[model samples]
Target: MRKSLAVLVSGYALAGLAHAMAPAAPEPDAPRTAPQAYAGLGVGLVDYSGGGSKASPKLFGGYEFTNKLALEAGGIDFKKGYGLYIAVKPTVPLTEKLSVYGKVGVAKSRREILPIAALPAAPLVRKNDTGAYGAFGLQYSITPNTVVTAEYERFGKKKESGAKEDVWTLALKFFF
Candidate 1:
């Protein structure tokens, strides 16, 4: 019984010593460092929209409002009568240089389609358009504000045509 009592007291003393040597815990209300903001410009080609395959150029700009939130804007074929869009994205970082994001946006597009002609008739083209779309994409940031992207976007059907515009694109982004 005496030997067991001595061992119990020694164990308690060792535990006390270990506790005294441990580091202090952080305060619960301390402010942590904020994540960096990132912005960029991008360009790419879009296909599977406007009634057929078309080569479209795009430009993009974005600001990271927080680590997981961003606002963006840009146009496709800005120099011509092309599609225009603006979007907001929620991004989640999966690694130091990789993240995935989804986008929602408004788009304006103007497209021309060739009209079907009968024999001995002249071929003509007509214009079709949409003023808005829902956009979505996945982004892989090679650097802090630059990314390689694959995107799919959908716009409401055009007037007088039971057709919707949806395109898949591959793009490169550059940070500013």
Candidate 2:
């Protein structure tokens, strides 16, 4: 019984010494949720329901009001067309370095149907249109100020062909 008691006391003392010698934990830096402005560029493929696809590039910028919300505006290049959009962006954090975000709002597009070589006359094309826009994406934070993302965006119906425009892209975003 005396031996067991001595051993128990020694263990407790050793544990206490180890705890006292351990380094203190540092406080974490400020949260990324603070309001910030950001910009991004993406390259992707655009597919149209009417029957064509092309490589597309997009440019965008926005202000994040919080970790969960932001406002963004951007432009995209499509096959024989182009689009500009403004959206409300909402985010869901999945982990310390990963998140899913969505964009919903309005879009303006201009498109044309090129005339065939054998065609006698060129078809008139619409210069501008206003419509709905949407998108969803996943982003992995590479640093507090940078993230890499993959997204799919849809610029709603085309009035000229009654088709939809969809884009899939990989992007890099920077926060300031």
Off by over 4 Å in 2: 1-31, 48-52, 116-120, 158-164
Question: Which candidate tops lDDT?
Answer: 2
Candidate 1 C-alpha lDDT tens digits along 37-151? 4444444444443444556666666666675787777666522346666777887777655667777777766654445545436554445464666666777766544578887
Error of 2 at 35 (Å): 0.4
Report the Cα lDDT for candidate 2. Answer: 0.82
- TM-score against truth, every candidate: 0.58, 0.74
Q: Which candidate leads the pack in TM-score? A: 2
RMSD of each: 14.8, 11.8
lDDT per residue for candidate 2 within 44-154, as digits (tens), equals 777654567667788999999997899999988775678899999999999888999999999998876555658859785555678899999999888788889999988
Please list the residue runs of candidate 1 whose C-alpha ends up more than 4 Å from where it truly belongs after superposition: 1-52, 78-81, 119-132, 158-164
How much lDDT does candidate 1 score? 0.61
